[model samples]
Structure formats: C-alpha cells, structure tokens
Target: MKNVTRRSALGMVVAAGGATFLAACGAQPQATSGNASESASGSASASASVSKSVRSDYSGVAVLEGYTSKPSDYQPATRTEPSKNAPVPVKPAVANENSVEGLYQSIAFFGAAMEYYMRTGKTEPLRESALDNSELKSILEPEKGTLGDGMQQGKIWMQDPSVTITMLSAQPERDGDAYNWDIRLTTDTGEFIASKDRVEEASSDDDRKTEVERTLHGVYENGAWKLTGMRTSSSSSSSASASASDS
Candidate 1:
C-alpha cells in the first residue's frame, strides 16, 4: 500500500495557498485616510492591500475605505482576520479504544478532522489531533503554518473547495510492541469491503473535491490509532457527481 511518489492531497490543496484577499479595510484612521487618498490619486494598487502578505505596521499602509456613495452606506465587512472561533471538531469516541475496528474508525476520524480544519479555517481540531511528533504532525504542521500566514494577512481561505481522504484496505504488520499499518490507503470514494454490504465513507464533498489516496502509516498508541507517517499513492480530482465505488 506504500508509494514513495505521492504527497498528501490535503497538503497539495493547502500549499496552493490561493485565498482571496480584500482590497480595502472597513475602517482606517483620519491621518491614514489622507495618505490613502494621495495613493488613490496616483494608482489603484497603491491605495489598497492586494497581496496575501501582511505588514508589521498597517498604519503606514494606505487603505481606502471603499465609498461608492454615502460613506455611511458602504460599510465594508469588518473581517480584520479569521474569526478563529470555529467550534472544535469532535473526535469519535470509538477512536479511543485499542482494537482493530477502533483503529479503522480512528483513522477515518483523523481524515475528517484534517479536512474540516482546511475547509473551515478551524485550527483547534487539527491542533488537538496532530500530536506526539508522529508522521501526521510532520505532514500537517507545515500546512498549519501556511494557514496562519493567510489568517494574519486577513486573506479569505478555501473558496469553492473539495477534498476527500479514502482509507485503503491493507494488512497490518507489527512494529515493536505497537502494531504498524504500513498505510496503503485511499482510492475512489467507496473501496472494497468484502466484510459488509457497505462501508462508511470517511468523508465526501461536492465542492470541487480533490481525490487523495495517500498511504498512511498508522500506529496504536495510548489506546488510540495515530497516523505515524505517510507517502502519496495517488492524487486526482473527484467529479462532482461521481458515484461511490460499488465494486
């Protein structure tokens, strides 16, 4: 199930870092307004913040409060930065148990949690889950830093986005005292499940979803399964109407 060639879909999407940025601030000081007016008289880009980079001192930066008519009527949204108040993603209770089925559920939970953070700009859930210097943290922490930068610059994150993580079927081998699932995971939304009539998809979305099948090295530790490390097995885009794998 391991492939050295592929990186994570989550990483790919986040690394793109093409979040939307607002041109003008909702409010700026009177002194700053004069400078903004001066800049506006010169060039469009000079009077507004366009890039995804933040400055140490915003006062010096000319931010024209967009006023089409009455300045009072055009109240631009006051989203200075990400609200950072997204509710923490709830982890599945079954993930805490040290068992085979529990391991499967735990891996699924991690997939869901990571996607949630990326989609909604929710940091708490990923922060809580990616821990212990395991492989998952290494893969995800860099993405976290990218998101942080976007937030600081007041850039809107994840527009019309789609992401999916498929836990592949593979055999687990023992690693020391802990078991190691040398993670060959991901494929179509639905994968083979000979044991049952159906499998609970880890997650699926219709918003331009990125199809990511990455091999995750899973380990059971402290009574839960954790993603230790990973390599990409495959990466592609999922059709909006693509049906789950029935085979």
Candidate 2:
C-alpha cells in the first residue's frame, strides 16, 4: 500500500495509498447514470442515490453519500475528530440492514475505515466491524495502522479523497450463514507532500486509470452486515488505463 495524506476543506485530514490519486482513493462506484467521475459537482462529493454534499452529523464524520440527509436526521457520532490529525471514529454497525444493503455498506465501511486510518492512526472502526477477527482484518489492519502512525507523527495528509463502487452484487453461501459479494471500484485520490504541502495526485503514467475487482465474504449479524474475508478476483492495470481516464 502507498502512503499519503490530504486535508479536506472542513479541516479534516484524509489519506490515500500509492503514487497517484487512484491508489489513494481505492475504488470508483458506477453511477446509475452519467459518468461517475464527471457527475460529482462539488468538493469531496460523490455520485450515488444518496447525496455526497457535506452535512453536519453528530458523529463528526461526514455523512455517507448514499444516505439521505435531512434536518431531522440525528444519530450518535460514529467518530471523533479531536484535531486534524486524529482518526475519525465511525459507528460500529449499521442499522436495519438487509442482505444486499448490509453487504454494500460493509464494503463502504472498509474504505471509510481506511480513510480514517490514513488521516489518523485509528483502527477502532475496523476492529468494531465484522472484519475484526476475519482474514481481511489480519491483512489490512496492521497496514492501516502503520500508515496512520506516519500521518499522526509525520503530519502528512491526503486531499480530495474519494471512493466509488461501480458495481456490487451478492449471493448466499451454501451454509446459509453468509453471502459472497463482488465489487468493481475506481478511486480518485492524491496526497499532500513536502514541507510546502505540495499536492500530488496518485498517478501512474498520467492519462490512465486503474480499476480493481475483488470479492468479499460477509455475514449479516446483529442488524448489520459484517465483512469476514476478501479475495482479489482480477485487476486492470495500464491496459485499461486509457479507457479509465477517458471516463
């Protein structure tokens, strides 16, 4: 994983992985219509059924884009932003989740946790999620922790960090206790580097984009879906870069 930090307008610090913005931001979500990359109109915004406009949440963490935000909305803060470098805490679990929704949220949760870890050296959200004792946890938790440590001590951050899931689907396992989900994603991410705070987009060859395809194992429990493990199904590197950048 690549390490870099960015700061949002809200005084929140974000993190991404790799040399280019794409690696920092993990995956892109396929929008229902229009190009997901071009459709987002504002800073730190995303394209999904739920609006990505920045909204105040009691939890301090920015409200997820796919969720409906209204003046009447209220929930306990899932994360705490004590300072620009502190990790943003996340709600431990989703509420009233169905299989499909739970699976989707779980995937989003992974990205969110990574972002929080990148900006701040916190893994509480990851530990709180279903990934806690799973294989994915073992694989990513320490890596996230290491990155967070650098951000916290080095004072580096990422900017304009965003993730999109272009495709998602799921099927029940033979044991009926869990579901296997597939996600196709793209990310536009970058970092703030150097003493002068120079900004660097996660770039490879420039004019190219990268897409990742992975499968996640999930189980719905305690009114929410939890991720247990994951496997990489396939990935597109420079071969699809031209097509990806065209989007």
Candidate 3:
C-alpha cells in the first residue's frame, strides 16, 4: 500500500538503464522528420552502441499539454499509485519558452510506466495510461519478452522509496514534424525496494544515490512529445567512487 513518487521511481529506471534491455543498434543521426527507423550501420561510432547503451527514459515521458492548442487550458493532475493495466493521469501545465514544464510531466509519466512495466512486465498499458506517439510506440514494441522474462525469473520489483531532483532544465528544438529536447536533471537515490512476490519477508534497501547529467532527445508527434534517445553526461555515486578507488 506504500505510495511511490516520480522522483523515487525515476532512479529505479535509471539504474536499469545500463542493462541493455533495448536494441543492439547504436544511435544514428535522427531525421528532422519522417522515417526514424535506423539501420545498425547508422549507429554512432564515437560512443557505445546505441542499443547497448542505457539511455535515461526520463526526457521522453509525454506531457499531455503539448497536445492542446491553448497552453493555458492544461490543468494539474494528481499523483496516484500506479495500477496494472491502468494509465497514469498527467495534470497539464504550460511550460516555459524552453518547455521545462512539459519535460517534467513527461518524466513523471515515464516513471509511472516504468513502475507498471516493472510490476506487470508489460508496456501495453502505456498506450492508454499515457500520451503516445510513433517514437514511443517504436521504443515499446521490441521489449516484450525481455521485460516479461525478468519479472518471471527474478520476481524482484523496484519502488522508489525516497528521492529528490535539483537543478532541472529542458531545452527544446524543432525537427521536421517532431520536437527534440535536451533535458538535464540530478537526483538523490533514496532507499528503493527489491521485493520478491512469493515471499512475505520484509524487504531490504539498496542505495542508488548518484549525480547524473544527460542529454535527452525526443520527437513530437500525435499531439504529444515522445522520447527518442538520450546520452548521459556523467553518472557517479559517492559510495561507488570510493569503492572504485579502493579497488
């Protein structure tokens, strides 16, 4: 019955970012508009393979306000515990000229989706529970078996116990029919849960507190802004830093 908040759950997704759950391809130069399907040969040569790299899903959570014509018409939404197959509700808000507000809401929506996918092993509910567009669809289509298998084999689920965000900003740009954003945020990884469904035993805590900086790439479509790609600027935890040096 414990309620999970966006900031808390966000780190769980960030932690999972490195697992390479998505495709094996690398990032290609995104089209200004139109076809986004990229071949493996198009992957960026300088960094990690796009498919193998863990991109923060935060920047791409769709904010519903972007879909409306009047920015002022948006209303704030209430936070609720996510349910299986149920969509998360986003209260609308106008963003600054740079689209800061929209980015925040989208991050929250992504948090909701991540929590649901972790609990239920499916992203199907995201289509209803949140705003959708072509980019979002493409991202969700490939991970069905992988996500389901993790849930079945590990039975280990994550919940953001506590977390906070500071120094957040989102810069926006236009590309063809879509918009791209560079979002940066820092979070305190609070105590998170790793629970086994079958056991009644009390859960244990894990530390994920880390400083992260990243550029989030997104595309706008279907009246919503959807995440398309991301690159971390830096990700480091104090504890982890010490452990590395000691080794």
Number of the candidate with higher lDDT, 1 or 2:
2
lDDT per residue as tens, model 1, 1-247: 1110111323333222111111111101011111111211123322322121223222111212221111232222222322233222345443444444444444544544443443344444444442234433433333222322332233433322222343333434456645454332222211111111221222344322333333445554444456544333243431111111112
Summarize candidate 2's per-residue lDDT along 19-81 as a digit string, tens digits: 112222111111122211232222312122121212222221223334322123222112221
Give the TM-score comparing model 1 with the true structure, all chains together: 0.43
Off by over 4 Å in 2: 1-89, 92-98, 132-148, 152-154, 170-175, 191-210, 221-224, 236-247
Q: Which has the greatest lDDT? A: 2
lDDT of 3: 0.32
TM-score of each: 0.43, 0.47, 0.39
Worst 10 residues of 2 by lDDT: 10-19
Number of the top-ranking candidate, with TM-score as the measure: 2
- Whichever of 1 and 2 has more TM-score, that candidate is 2
Poorest lDDT segment (10 consecutive residues) of candidate 1:
21-30
Off by over 4 Å in 1: 1-88, 130-148, 151-154, 160-162, 170-209, 231-247
Task: Itemize residue pairs with steric clashes in candidate 3.
Answer: 25-51, 26-50, 61-106, 75-92, 76-91, 77-91, 87-129
